[model samples]
Target chain A: MSLAFTRRALLKTAAAGAAAAALSRRTAAQASGRVVVVGGGFGGATCARELKRKGLAVTLVEANAVYTACPFSNAVLAGLRPIETQQFNLDAVEKEGIAIIRQRAVRADPQARRVVLEDGSSQDYDRLVLSPGIDIRFDALPGYDEAAAGTMPHAWKAGEQTILLRRQLEAMDDGGTFVMVAPANPFRCPPGPYERASLIAHYFKTHKPRSKLLILDAKDSFSKQRLFQAAWQELYPGMIEWVSLSSGGKVIEVDAKTRTLVTDFGRHTGDVVNVIPPQRAGQIAQAGGAADRTGWCPIDPVTFESRLQPNVHVIGDASIAGGMPKSAFSANAQGKVCAAAVASLLRGEAPAEPKLINTCYSLVAPDYGISVAGVYNPRNGVLTDVEGAGGTSPVSAPPSFRAQEAVYAEAWFQTIAREVYG
Target chain B: MARLASVLTMGGMMSVAVVVMVKTMPAAAQGVAPPGATSCSGCHGPGVSDAAVPPLHGRPSEEIVAAMQEYRNGRRPATVMDRVAKGFTDEETRAIASWLSQQP
Candidate 1:
């Protein structure tokens, strides 16, 4: 089927379902509407659960059968966590009576209120929630493409690619160089790259003490720089090396077959290279005209509705929520809030504009963790940061606090996992 | 009579101290803004540039609240913003929203 016809049919079906549900609830004191959510990650999953709990019929779509988290996938690289530790089934959410469709969304019909599926089937909804995490813009990086990724893994997606990178690390001999190419900003998990480097170093410290690690970063300063540096100095000094943008750390090209990473400064060859390229909103956003020049969807903060499309909402990593960082937790929170607004609108009531929360924790080592938190609100339809609303992990903290941070990090993972899948 | 006066002075001093100790303090120390509102302009104001960090003034309050709430709730994964929002109350967030809406 053509993409256009598919979208129209989906929208028509949703409108008809909504009309029938509305009539059925006319005397029931509550209205029913179908809210279809794309991407079953942290953002989409939580939003689906919230909508379902609020008495809305929700259909959740995901490209994969199981959910794997990138937050602690670093531990997978370090051998601290087995791959299965980060894997979760959607059984809990399925038990909640949410209609689950294990298919990737190909396109969104904003006018028709339907999502086109990879299998050529489509679903219609009164409200659509999109939270597909991110799209790796490999073309943005010279010499890096799908074919190149096969040779040099960009394990940014946190599933099979993660294991592939880990296996590559395991195969390297002592004194071998492990190269990590950090992506530009506006990507998921700001602290992820640093945490990943720290964990990989941990692996080499015990197994291959003479081996070295090099990080070529696109940005000058990174999240939790001080804390990460302090931890690295204390734990594994002279083992991990970082080159920043000012020092010519930005990777301009790569020869994956040769395992060489070329920065403006010089070329460095490594036995294994993990290159994370620039990112943008997921494919569905680009297909729907929701993406901007920067490749992220612009939305009205109050409604999460696409600025270009009237009834379609974008959430998670796919939306341009300026001043807001994309994280699994952030996406999940936005999903719930978006669900609330969508449900209220469907009920013919004005949606309550809401405050949002974001918190990110990065484990510097097995025993150490640091985090930052913030509360955000909308101003003039643009998302703005709240002042004095959030801060970072304390520096030079006592042992008790460090230990406590580690405990909190684990608890946080569990909480977010449940919020998304359950 | 002098002795009696001294006793009364000491007793009153003790009473004041006890009362002060029992009184509840606000969530954050003094000179702080309430949650979700004008309280954020303190550090996020102009003249404080953290590289690419954008200024929070003159933006929409609805977006501000959602962003703040996103930080506080861990929906947005930021390092510093999340910690700052842990101190907010829902009512204070509304108050902050009101104050931000009136700003430029």
Candidate 2:
């Protein structure tokens, strides 16, 4: 059967159960009304599935037919996991009666509650869910553009770029340097760059002992600094080096052809260069008028409804969720909350005060792991970390403890992937 | 406490120690999963090949409560649950367990 939808059954259900919901504070709720979700990554896919489960007609628009997840992608680069394992085809969700539109969302017509696709077709929604993860600010730095990405290889989005960087590493001479330039604050996965460095360092230790890895960081410190530094000392000592911003580690420009990064005071060259650029909300979010000057969509803490657009909600990395980092775990959590709120709004009921949780586990090596977690509760109109109840992996833990965490890290992936994708 | 807060302000995901105390919880509600309870499914999700974490659906509420209380009080050793358990009140935990129990 065609995958766009199985409307024969859906129309029968909609006709049988005409909803009798009260008029919403803003607009009347249609229990069987359409919800169009943009982006099929963690947040949008989860939201689409949840809305369908709530007995709503849901459509998910995505640029790619298949999704490549970013979580655990660093392992793919280090040869710890195969790239095939990172891919997800939404067969499970498709069978659940969700219409998966394989097309790019070019614009969002919030005023008409419609989404315009690259092919000029449009889907009208009673409610719109925008979960466009992030867009790399391509020319934010000089000498770096779409063409430069072919050479430098951001690999930040996973998939083909991830393999490009890995192949480059494999082809490099044993003694050649692999350098990564990490972006400043407000990026996806705060602990990600350090974890990449650690796992890559592990790969070097086993295959090319003479090779070295260098990190040119925009910030002087990062999440789980002590744990990562300690793991580097114990697992791959003297094989990795970090350059903090105070020491001119921040790259002002780059020469992609020459593989050189121009910092404030000096120039550094590497056999392999990975540039993680600054980011903003995806194109649709900006086009839909959901995003603000900060390059992120501001939303109500309770319902995640866009502050700028009525009947439109933004979640995941694109939304400014307080005290929540841009991680898949956070996106999944936000997806649930946003889905529930949309259901309630359609039913003309006030949204509930929900508690959100985030746990980010980073593998410093195949066997060594570190994490940071928090529970975000609503406080004074914002989500705040619950007092006395959130923290990172404890310092000075034994090797066995780290090993156990590594096991849990894999479980975390298996469980979340099944929940969201299926 | 002041020093710890200063450290947390950097990453903003740190926690303070909590004294675990058991208290009377509300009777479980039916129909829908609680707000905080949905987050649990992100990790303790559907029973698929049975990995390191156990799926929570359909377990007895009493059994789930006892386990959560133990983790909250540090009596049960866990990689991360000890910290997560302290985030919820006894009432919230009981409601979630009740919801999970009602699930098929």
Candidate 3:
């Protein structure tokens, strides 16, 4: 594509006139209220920025100075892209007039409408948004804890763990086996494990042809199973193996010392073991009483307001967002809707009915991609997919379509990054 | 300084030109977006110049309304739009078209 049609070009045009106009109008009508957001990932950052743009007093609290995105971390693992490319700074968001507090939020006091930071400071808000992503339930899997993570990296959080796993792959012998234990459903990035398997297989194809990848999945099936299976068969036949739960694929425990995985059927040893454990709402959500037995926060689908805590909202992976997956794009979409709703509520007006959209793209290979899209609205207090609204890429599509989707996937990442961070 | 002055002058003229142009078209409700229209902006709004996803701003209202009606009725072959169009009522579609048409 031409540079003139890139995401940056479009952003310049949109921001120069349309967005400024919208902001001025919003400022004229909306009442200013303090909105505090915890976590500076896709959802929290977007919420903070959007609220600020709409003339709200906004503050964002984050533990990290930079965010390494999870969306394309699989590419980093496959050696297709460097991990540095996935890291983003907060310059753009800070420039937008949202206060950035580089501190860990330890607790939320809903009654007081404030978030307590690790430094003993508290930021109060008329409205609070929690987008703390997910916390790995290390106890869910025996023998898999922080210590074990050093040897068998989950690499799901997309930072140091990603580098560790990549190094493990590099050190493995040509004929060695790499075992991956996929997490159960409701985890972040439903199609991620399969995509990682495909990319790793691609890596082995080019670098270590004799190497084999074994995917021990906890779920019976996964997102884009057929598409992934088709790509595996066509691209890296016999190099990758996938075992489902019914076939004794669920990993019950691990012996990190021996680098062995224990499943219901048998124990298998590998040169490298990557275990993605079960997940729950980030600790702050649970501590704040926003999450329930399911380990996810329940919310009003219309405004993403926490059902348990008044005036507090949850978005991103930590929330039970009906049918939406815990992807970066979904978080960004929910952030915008929540911002609009909060802006209206601050003005003492009823929140506008919201419509949510999501599109997740997974690359099977460098030039081959697949996607799923959906449009959703609140129905019976839960977000439900609009009938016949969105679907996945056609299985019978030509190679060119997949190639185009790969390009579109990159464009989407660029556009969403600019939208949320810049 | 001269270039900055020329750019500011052009920007002022552009804003004036837009006002005059919008005044010529039949005036619609100013601020409110249609109930379901904001969702479309996620993909089709400003800063998205993808050929596959057309920008919705500055389009003729009648043309947009006609296209949405066709999508809703299954006359348009769409990957996703047909289903999304069905979510909006005809009046809602017209409202969206009217609002988007007025955008710069």
Best by DockQ: 2
- Predicted structure with the largest lDDT when compared to the true one: 2
lDDT of 2 by residue, B7-104 (tens): 22421211110001111222342376686888888887744423456666655688778878987998766668778888989999999888876654
- Cα lDDT tens digits, model 1, A1-422, are 36785675455445534543443354234434877888878778878887887778777777566678887899898889899989876668867867777667898888787788887877767778878878889889999998888888888888888999999999999899999999888787888999998888989998999999899999999888898898899888999999999999999999988988898779998888999888898888888778889898999987798898777889988888866778876786687678778878888987666667677777777877788666677888977776766657877876556655675577567656655664
Q: Write the per-residue lDDT of candidate 2 for residues A321-392, one digit (tens) a residue.
A: 888889999999999899999999888888889999999999999988889999997788777898888788
Tens digit of per-residue lDDT, candidate 3, span A184-299: 88899999998898988989999999999999989998988888898899889999999999999999999999999999899999998899889999988998889999999999
Residue A79's lDDT in candidate 1: 85
Would you list the clashing residue pairs of candidate 2? A390-B14, A390-B15
TM-score of 3: 0.85
Instruction: Check candidate 3 and list the clashing pairs.
Output: none
Sort candidate 3 into its docking category: incorrect
C-alpha positional error of residue A203 in candidate 2 after TM-score superposition, expressed in Å: 0.4
- State the DockQ of every prediction: 0.11, 0.34, 0.15
Residue A318's lDDT within candidate 1 is: 88
Q: Candidate 2: where are CA atoms >4 Å away?
A: A1-32, B1-30
